[model samples]
Target chain A: EAGVTQFPSHSVIEKGQTVTLRCDPISGHDNLYWYRRVMGKEIKFLLHFVKESKQDESGMPNNRFLAERTGGTYSTLKVQPAELEDSGVYFCASSQPGRGSPLHFGNGTRLTVT
Target chain B: GESVGLHLPTLSVQEGDNSIINCAYSNSASDYFIWYKQESGKGPQFIIDIRSNMDKRQGQRVTVLLNKTVKHLSLQIAATQPGDSAVYFCAEKGISSASKIIFGSGTRLSIRP
Candidate 1:
């Protein structure tokens, strides 16, 4: 019943710092997705997780970013040595992996790198 | 990268009037298209969706029209209200069947009350 939930609605970190964003999808949802939207840019897909496996990670920007969904539950995205370009709102979404289940999105974690 | 772009970057509409937002997608293989509404400091919320087969689909107060020929998509809001003010993004689902939604640049809808 509860929608997808994300933690730390807003985060402020200095450049070259490490930050982790978390997302817990809906109950029984097997599909989870991560997206990032820079200022005045389109919402870019980062990766997707099906259960505990990484479904598609081709969208990952660089090696500094890592995503994991261990035990087939929640997922986390970690940014190491964050750069100025890594500053953006990170969004997590989940769906039932059906034809038209409609992805439920969290409020998003706005990571501001100063 | 595939560009699912909007015809107008922004649109202004008077309250109680109708508002139309347009988007053009490059991937002809994209079979599913959806429109999402995102308020400030929030994630995208699905408004309505249309498949490649149907030319038009209507929701409670929103309608999505898909023109596969031109690869164009449009969302029409009835009785536009100030509460509807937000950035509306048109997303196209890649034909992968996993329903990967790639978003557009988004259109900021401003309602003049």
Candidate 2:
């Protein structure tokens, strides 16, 4: 089976610009999650998706960030008016949460905001 | 509490020798834990995981130990090889959420051939 894959491996955007990161999870996986790691910081969860619906978004940083998983196949995370602090590695992970299976991660999109 | 930490930011070992990396977590309520190894420019790959119910769990040449009483976790690699070099991070799953895992700052492991 193919592992999770993230798009653009790296992205650079000027301040106040909008950027979209894409994640394709493993086939047949029921749960998809978004996490990020800022420079020198531990990885933190942003949100989760079960199918095409948002499960828990409490970890979302701010209102400018939005995520969509239409058709429950892949996921897209969009950041509008990106700030310098938004620069970090955004990771996409998937898991078979039904039986407590561990999550599998993708290479991640390294976003740089100037 | 509930913060995961590593004993050292980096570790160096000789190839063919056993490698041990230590981690300390602060969450007593954290019952599920995992150890992930991330190579340069790659995502974290799962090595092994242990629950609070078990003190140790083993995988292909890798072992994970969890001590709930001390809030500690560790990963041991037998016959460590040059390919073992990477950043190792221990994560404690969020008991408050539905299997949300929080990662540590990570420890970079270097192997001398």
Candidate 3:
């Protein structure tokens, strides 16, 4: 089985621009999660989707950032008017519905805002 | 505020030697713990995991030890090789499914030949 896959391995955008990152989890996985690591920081959780419904989104940094997993197959994260602080690595992971299933992660999308 | 943190930011070990990475977590209620290895330009890969019910779990050449008393966690790598060099992170699963997994700052393991 293929691992979680992310698109646009690297992205460079201007400070006020918008960017969208995509993630395709492994087949038959019902739990999807989004996390990020800023420069020299720990990887922090952003949100999670259990199928088409959002399981948790308390980690979302601000209103400019939005994430959706329509139909529960794949997910996307969009950042509007991206700021310099938004430069970091965005990672996506997935796991089975039940507990004890290890989370499978993608290579992640590196976003650079200048 | 719940936080998971490592004792060291970097560790250098000679090839063929053993390496131990330590992490301290603030949440005593965390029931599950995991260790992940991340290489450059890649996402974290699951190395090993141990539930709160067990004190130690071993896999291949790696071992995870969980100490609930002090809320401490450690990963031991046997006969460390150059290929084992990477950032190793210790994460904790929160109390509920809605609680996202919290990761530590990570320890960069460097193998010196």
User: lDDT for every model?
Assistant: 0.91, 0.89, 0.94
- Rank the candidate models, highest DockQ first: 3, 1, 2
Better of 1 and 2 by lDDT: 1
Reference-based lDDT, residue A83, model 1? 95
Candidate number of the best DockQ? 3
Clashes of 1: 0
What's the TM for model 2?
0.94
Encode model 2's per-residue lDDT on B16-94: one tens digit a residue: 9999999998877787889999887999998898878899999999988887788889999999998999999898875
* Candidate 3 chain A weakest lDDT stretch, 10 residues: A95-104
Relative to the real complex, the DockQ score for model 2 comes to: 0.58
- Candidate 2 lDDT, tens digit per residue, A1-106? 9999999899999999999999999999879999998995778889999888898898899999999999999999999989999999999999975534788999
Residue-by-residue lDDT tens digits, candidate 3, B48-95: 999899999999999999999999999999999999999999999965
Looking at candidate 3, what is the lDDT of residue A23? 98
Worst-scoring 10-residue span by lDDT in model 1 chain B: B92-101
Q: Kindly report, for each predicted structure in the order presented, the TM-score of its chain A compared with the true chain A.
A: 0.96, 0.97, 0.98
Off by over 4 Å in 1: none
Q: Which of 1 and 3 is ahead in lDDT? A: 3
Candidate 2's displacement at residue A106, Å, is 0.9
Interface RMSD of 3: 1.2
Q: Pick the candidate with the highest lDDT.
A: 3
User: Model 2 segments beyond 4 Å from truth?
Assistant: B94-97
